[model samples]
Target chain A: MERILRIFFNNGSFFTFVGLQLLCLYLIINYNSNQAAIAAETWSIRSGKFKSALTTVNGYLDLREQNEIHRREIARLRSLLPESGYNITTEIDSIQDDSLLQRFNFLTTRIVNRSPYNPNNTLVIDRGARFSVQPGQGVMNESGLIGIVDRTTDRHARVLSILHQSTRISAGLANRGYGTLRWNGLDPRRMTLIDLPDYVPVAEGDTVYTTGFSNIFPTGQVIGTVEKTERQPGAGSLNLTVLLSNDPLRATHGYVVQDLFKEELGSLNEN
Target chain B: MRGNDAISNALRFLLILFLQVFLFRQVSLGLGGKEYLFIYLVPVFTALLPLRTPRPLVVLFSFLLGISVDLFYETLGVHAAAATFVGYARQFALGLLEPRDGYKAKSSPEGKDLGNRWWMQYLLLMVGGYCVFFFSMEAFSPVYWRDIVVKSLFTIPVSWLFCIILVTFLRPRI
Candidate 1:
């Protein structure tokens, strides 16, 4: 018994090492989606608070540019709205009835923290669950679709940027018809639009927009412009290369579009 | 002896964590390749710590360093796994360099200490091991075989180059 005890103690370090490895392996294997969501939310909130405090010190420098951009956006939205006989109560009812349009309503926020360095890059926005921002909401800059909300906390949300490998948006050719917008993780400026029918008249410089198939994004939001197209022989689809509308590196502010019907849509699908 | 060493080691770990999370993370090699070179060097810092340490202590530090990096990199437990692997292999790396008994106190493992020729071998072994573990855990499936190969090949050398430079410049004073 004493000899056996000595042998066990001699190799005790190795056993401990193996035990730790097993623990880590378990962590890796049992890494739940819910845990990831929670972690993402916590990270977003913490980073957002830190970045917001940091950016506030520097925000004054960009005030002129930001004000001009805001004015231009308000003007654009005004132009889109019906000019005559529009009442506030009726508009509110209309917004409620059309969940997609309601879902398109945005909470403007500064990008407190951002990472363009990752294959599945995420951005932190200074707004969150308390502000009604939720996961799977669409995020966009003034130019176009930026990403989708992945997680949210009380004071911030993390957006899985379009630059991420996991980002897949239902997009279609403005000139042609339907396709899936996917990032190849090769070029930040360009993305690939696949599953496009070969017969679609895909011209160079043609615009691409969201199809609104998903509850996340509104229909007709611009995504990018087709830079090149190739018809693969025997394949029914065309390979299209698109230059993304927004330069991720330069974007500082964005809006998170809350998908009001997401719960309803989810429940309906389950039934 | 153990307690003082533990405190200093903890301090060093915190310093490296701050550097990775706040400063080096912002430095990205763009063009959609999706690579962060400077941040990968954080593990090498832990791996290059003095070899007189207990094996369990080394592994513990490696796990701590890796998990801290994972927190910032948003990669979950991948960096933790790779860093621990490198920590385990550090003894073998030293064996391939100088004789185990001939090692000096407070000297960092680097190209100079291990000699330049053997240093390349050491760096390749450690960095290659790190990259393989990192990319494999990240890819996590055989379906992304092409992507895994391409990403690993692109990132490994860049990470190794960063590790070499950092070790050379930050070699501990004898």
Candidate 2:
């Protein structure tokens, strides 16, 4: 502090010297437009950077609110689907209502725990009876389908991850052919699709989707992409190694998808 | 700082102030165009301040003198600020040309008592400083730096000539 004083007033009466200079500066700033503009610009740049820094520092504090907003957005989009009218060949009357539907609803949850090394890798999700979550509902995130709910407690549910060896989900291709998607239990990133004929026009890079044949997941939902194909010469069947869209082992958030028409669909299938 | 010096210096101050504002300040040099020039003489009063006057007192007196002139010229504070600058610089100005006797035996600075050479040097420093500062502040912008220089150069000699004529003729009883 004493050094600072010395710098301002090296002479005996530096107080008067400094005070007059400060008064001149104040007057200049008030009366000078060009100088005032420069000053204002400097302040704006400095303050803007400071405000952004402060926001980044507090970003972690708003994570829960941000997550809640994203969850609500996904739920809203879930109940609405594209209309068939977008197709030129389909009749306008055949188009279903594209407005919000009660047929599909979602409740978002977090993955509390999960395992990949086990033969039946199951996920413990952070929603159960308290969130109206039930067994057999398909679970997914924005990237694509992950699993089906297997059991529930008051506040949590256990899901059978698609990585399980016993899992067999009917899959669809862009050409409308059928295949079975199953995890081989060795490489966690690879899922095997089988029972489609080689004449099905299958390609290595073609996308595979859920067929909605079992009424578990919505029709046209993404399953994975074809990675490689194997031909059984005698059986005339093609086996495909599919690459899952997003690694479920690394996923943190989830949504339980409920199908409102599941009972009707099940009864129809039984008949 | 003394009785005699105060009386004599006050008389010189009033005399120079009157002649400057009433007579010299009104003179105009023009070329019949939109251009003209001002003749400055009030600085002579500041230039003739007693050599041994205390630095602080000199600054204060010069400030008061400049401000009083500003009242009539209506360019308030410009004159005062310029005068104060000259007042503060007087010590250093004299330092550039110190005497063997070291500023002793001098009641007032004049061409008669001090040699014409010493007096002219002193006059140049005081008037030159006052004019540069006054015109720079009057212009109020650095873009007119050349303008300030030209005005100071023209003002210095004319003001300097008028001061000699006053000190020699009017002889304010110092």
Tens-digit lDDT string for candidate 1 (B1-174):
221255555656776678767877787663566653333666665555666776666777787788778877776676787777777766666676665577767654544546767666677788887777776666565665776677667777877787677656545421
Best by TM-score: 2
TM-score of each: 0.43, 0.45
Reference contacts reproduced by model 1: 0.22
Predicted candidate 2 versus true structure: per-residue lDDT over A172-194, tens digit per residue: 79899888888888887889999
The worst-scoring run of ten residues by lDDT in candidate 1 chain A lies at A95-104
What fraction of the reference interface contacts is present in each model, in order? 0.22, 0.00
Error of 2 at B150 (Å): 2.3
Clashing pairs in 2: none
Clashing pairs in 1: none
- How high is the CA lDDT of each candidate model? 0.74, 0.74
Off by over 4 Å in 2: A1-271, B1-4, B31-36, B110-113, B170-172
